[model samples]
Target: MEPWPFDTITPEEIDALTDEEKQGLDAAVAAYIGECLRRRGVDPAPPTSTPA
Candidate 1:
């Protein structure tokens, strides 16, 4: 991945990720953002899952 500016990454860069990598990144970022929101008194909705 390119160096720095992670928060402003472009879609073309994200498109380089494999399916599994994309899902993993999505989950990680979601968790991090959710935690940050909760820390600031914003209650995030409960996570839901669907069977593959």
Candidate 2:
């Protein structure tokens, strides 16, 4: 995977991204988080049902 695009960004900078760019960034962030969780032996799956 490629390196992350930015080390830090302001809200205005995020707001300036195009829809496609925003989607790409969102996916990248999610993947990065999932990988980190996996490395820590944490399950990343969502619960199958909500708690009562």
Candidate 2 lDDT tens digits, 1-52: 8765677876779889988898788778778989999999999996466322
Candidate 1, pairs of clashing residues: none
Model 2, position 13, has a per-residue lDDT of 92
Report the C-alpha displacement of residue 14, candidate 2, in angstroms.
0.3
lDDT of 2: 0.80
Q: Which portions of model 2 show Cα errors greater than 4 Å?
A: 1-7, 45-52
For model 1, the superposed segments whose C-alpha errors exceed 4 Å read: 1-7, 46-52
TM-score of each: 0.66, 0.69
TM-score of model 2 (CA atoms): 0.69
Clashing pairs in 2: none
